[model samples]
Target: MWSRALRSNLKLSKSEACIFFKNKIRGASTCVEGEPEGPVVKTDIPGPKSKQLLQELGSLQQVGTIQLFANYDKSIGNYLVDADDNILLDTYTQISSLPLGYNHPELLKVFNDQHNMKCLINRPALGVFPGEDWPKRLNGILSEISPKLPNITTMMCGSCSNENAFKNIFIAYQRKKRGDVDFSEEEKSSCVLNQPPGAPKLSIMSFKNAFHGRTLGSLSTTHSKYIHKIDIPSFDWPIATFPQYKYPLEDNQRENEEQDKKCLSEVEELFEKYEKKGIPVAGIIVEPIQSEGGDNEASPQFFQQLQKIAKKNNAYLLIDEVQTGGGCTGKFWCHEHFNLETPPDIVTFSKKMQLGGYFHTAEMTPRQPARVFNTWMGDPGKLIILQTVLRVIKEQKLLDNVLHTGTLLKIGLLELEKEFCYLLNSTRGRGTFLAVNATDSKLRDEILTKLKAKGIQSGGCGSNSVRLRPALIFQEHHANIFLDKFRQVLKEIN
Candidate 1:
């Protein structure tokens, strides 16, 4: 029934069919072989069924931010099906985490093995009593994508991964400072009271408009929004200005270079200011691309210089790949594009990787057994899925697919910006990690709402930017559908 509806709704001209839909799988994308050809907007977005489900969920817990309830069973590939049966092309891909899209047969077969099932059910306190296979499994993860780091400290989510990473940075910093000396009685006692020289005033310098995480330690470095940290107590850390580049990078080369210099100078100044104020910066936690805060990007030079700044201050550089990792930006890690002098001191990840964890250098290794410990450090179940995810990513050459699709997506956005100059601009990003700024915040929200009505699920960041986070499986055909719909919507609004 869905396939029939799709065929009728997407019966295109010969040229259009050749460009978009081909020999696609039934009920999948019209253009792709196994996904829906086009989005289906049968009812008003967040239609009655979704509204009813949301109300039910709200009664049980907070659902104030719930826009619509998904019918997970019906969702597939690059499309999400809401409870009302509205099928929307999901460019944001659950905020850029769904790697292979919903129910990719490869992932579903992961638990088919009885051994895999056993591992999933028999949870372990990995910090203390890891399973026999734990060593090999972790090694496999590290070997494939460790950012040249030697060790892994697994945690629960992006927030905790970063929180524990903060602890690791502090411990390593103090270890270097104290020169392997045992803690003095006064030092121990002062720590209990959370005083200086024990608790210490070390800070992690972060960029303005950067989002690390929401845990107490990570939240201290997050500068994205007020809602996430409004009532929460935060650390008084140095907030360096991030580069705010002008659009058409080539056209504004001089201006953008100035922007980078201005931001980099502020960082240099903050380091001096923090030191003089007696709160030494022990580390810097940053997203290569400032996601959530905005789809703001920096030049390769910016990252290269940022690394130098950290090294000069003897600070650990933690690249928070929680959002930008897992092949979204065409690389196994987004920071790989920077061509840094050395791998970052630490790299944190979660989201598409299926679990939260930090990979760090041997220097960052904790001397004490339980210093960065947690019960059930991370779910083995998530590992099982991750193992499969990694395998599928390799077998299907998904990283290459991302690079291909990302270029197509960025080009479409650039072309759309040209036609709708008043409404869109600043089409920028690496790989599929792309975005365009709307005229204003109000128009941004309106565009997002109308896109959903036309069966496109996009997200907003910074204040006025529309971000695109299509899955790795997203192909040129998918880009064409998106561009066509985008053009239609721009015409509607313009």
Candidate 2:
């Protein structure tokens, strides 16, 4: 019965699907032709199925953060269906990871090709034994979404992407130290014992409230939440301040500039202090727009200046775009907005890109093999999905949609801020990678809860920010629904 309904919901007719790639922009109707006109809240948020499943799952493992269980098959287009069958306009988009909403027809058909099916089932140990078409698959990703960086090292997830990028940076730094000399036996021997010279006391500079990932090495750089980092011992690396720009940025121009200056100065000071203290900073990893940290954005000048600083300090700069990349900011890589003199030493990505990897310069390439090696470097199946996703993005002109849709969402947010000045503030972000701060953390969570009840799924970042991370295919009509629902929720909150 659901399949019958789902079939009707999928605007999978060849004509409707092909409407965008050829003629003028056709909007999201072509993407999910039979998608719901608006969200349908069938139950009270977590409803019955969600609560029951949560309880059942809770008995097995930790499910503290499990807000609701999703019925992925039933989910379509921009809507997510919870276990209770309540449909939500999923602005959160599986933590900003889903490029297209659930079950895009093009993607669903990918496995129809036997070769693609074989690739899906026969997962290879990519590092040791990649399939014949691996290089082509990799090159496809590069050609389609290259950050202008020369090489890429694929890994398992966002954490490992940054983790291995850190290794690459360290290896490069060490190679520079080695110059023409070969590694001494003592260096090798001491490294085995986790001692100096080989396993040197190097550090990566990260920002306060920045979230790179949760793996040990990457976790050290993640300062978004105490919950993610507490209990586990972490590296004592430098944590510089990310600029907290005042909202109504036009009104706070001078102050924001000063904020950037102060933050940059501290970054410089950290480099000097760390260098003198013996634990030299090998790399600097920062998110383009700190998503989990509350959608904090810095000036292009700040990034440009930071890049220069990385060069000055002989440290590699890594732009962590796990959340901000994949055309969310109307660019393939969010760092493109910075307009740096040259590409940064490395750019790490995952989440929405279908795989975790870092696009890097040749200098960062480890001379030694297995330094960044793992059993399965990255899933080939994901590459297949990614290739299709990239094609759809190009054919449908999702970037253009993002730019236009983002403009509408931003304008609406500004208007809402005006009307609910006391309840909301600090409206900012790029594209649909947007967020707004409520009066306090309680209010922020309340806004998310209310939004969910209203059949819109929003996420909260920082202490008081309600983040909007709609899918790439999200259009003006979706934005209107979100804006309307948001206004309704705000009125009720007031």
lDDT of 2 by residue, 1-494 (tens): 64343223331234422332232354344566668888998899788988999899999999988889899889998989888889889899989999988889899999999999999899999988899999988888787778888799998899999999999998999889889578999899999999987899999999999999999999999999999988999988999999999977778989999999999999999999998999999999999999898899998999999999999989999999999999988778888878999998899989898899989998988777888999889999898898989999998888877766776688799899999999999888876788999999998888889888899998998889999888998988889999999999999989
lDDT for each of the candidates? 0.85, 0.87
- Candidate 1 lDDT over 1-494, as tens digits, reads 65444334332234433323332322222222356777999998789998888888888999888888898898988889988889999998887888888878877788899888888888888988888888999999999888999999888999999999999999999999999989878888898899967888889999999998888989999999999999999889999999988888868889999989998889889889999999999998889999998888889899999899889989999999999999988788999988999999999999998899989999999887888988989988898899888888898767766765665677688889999999998888877888899999999998998888889998989999999888888877777888888888889988
Q: List the residue pairs that clash in candidate 1.
A: 21-31, 24-33, 25-33, 28-35, 28-36, 29-35, 29-36, 29-37, 30-36, 30-37
Model 2 spans with C-alpha error above 4 angstroms: 1-29
Best by lDDT: 2
Question: How high a TM-score does candidate 1 get?
Answer: 0.93
Query: In model 2, which range of ten residues has the least summed lDDT?
Result: 3-12
